[model samples]
Target: MSEKRSFLLQKQNDAGKLNQSKLLKAEENARLLVTLQKKKKEVEQLRLQYKLLQAEQSAANKRIDALKQKLAEKARCKEAPRVHPINPPCLETDACLRQTAIAYLKARKQGNASALSRHFAPDCNYQYANNREVPNEMVMNNIRELWEKWPQRSYRLLKVAYRDNHVELIYIYKYADQRNHSIQGYAKEKWETNSAGQIIHWREELHPGTSPAESAGYRLVPLNIK
Candidate 1:
């Protein structure tokens, strides 16, 4: 009976000690949980601070970009300068008919209808291939018609001579047809007596391709066509 009683008492004491140990362990777990909650709160605050810093950085970048754009515009304004054209510009005077022919050629080349009408006299004549004489109106009309037909036409001045009222010129007529062919040419022109030395009648000869004898001639005279 005594031994059994002692065993029973030892079991009861062991059970009480185990209960106390369990209470201490529970308190330790509670303190650790509180520490974890505080750490979580601190982490959330730091994340908020980081997000605010990122937003500030983004706004600062936008402001810097805007400032750079404004600076670029100001630089562009400083770099660019304005220039004005000279009024009543000085005109080039090379020779008598030379200047006139140059003006004529420039106007003719640009297909300036108004310029052509001013220079070309109504009573004009032209002589073409085989001593053929064509009217001045016909020659002028031919030029206008041909230019209208071929817009990309060009003429190269080969040679030119002028003395008092006598004028002569040579040119190679070309179109954009990509043909490596050039015609040797000569023109004899006489200014009209009534029209203040305007070209009235003209005659021309052309050495076709490489032909010295297989040549062509043209004559042109102008009259009032209206």
Candidate 2:
């Protein structure tokens, strides 16, 4: 009987140990679950913060782009330094017309006399203020004579007007050395271009007392200094 009671006691002790181990495992599982839930919450908060950062960065980029565009527009306005807008016959032909006119003037100032012919039509006519119409054959000679009289001649274009096939210019003419005389005058010129963009007709209207004579006594045109 005592042996049987001892065996019963050992079996009861084993059952109690098993029950205690099961309880410990259950407590550990609960602790792990709580920790996992907290970790998940932290992960979700981090994701939300990341989304907010992306949105803010996008807005900043848009603002930078807008500022850059504004600066570019200001730069464009500063670069254009024209006093008056030039209206060409056709938008597509504006550049060519202006380029040709500039090149012609540059050639004349540089004393490239032979280059002048290429800018004019075959049957060009030049009329002076005295109603003297110089024929095509005498154009180069007249130009050479004018250049010889005032070797230091220069022109400042004051105003320019343009039409479909015509251009009118007002200019201030200056010759620093005409027998030690500083001569200046105003002149108006009109140019008529052919369909091929070659100058076919030209007219000159020099202000009174502006014409120079070859003689030493008439080295300067008599006019008020003003």
C-alpha lDDT of residue 38 in model 2: 99
Q: Over the stretch 1-226, how does candidate 1's per-residue lDDT look in tens digits? A: 9999999999999999999999999999999999999999999999999999999999999999999999999999889895432111112212344456566667667887667656655556554423344544565776787566666656555444443334455555555423533333333333332225556556555544532221233121111111
Off by over 4 Å in 2: 1-88, 129-135, 208-226
Residue pairs of candidate 2 with colliding backbone atoms: none
Best by TM-score: 2
The C-alpha lDDT values of all candidates are 0.57, 0.67
Candidate that scores best on lDDT = 2
Predicted candidate 2 versus true structure: per-residue lDDT over 1-226, tens digit per residue:
9999999999999999999999999999999999999999999999999999999999999999999999999999899796542334453444455456566666667778768777767666677424444555567667777777777767665544566567665567776556856677877667787767767788767774553222222112112111
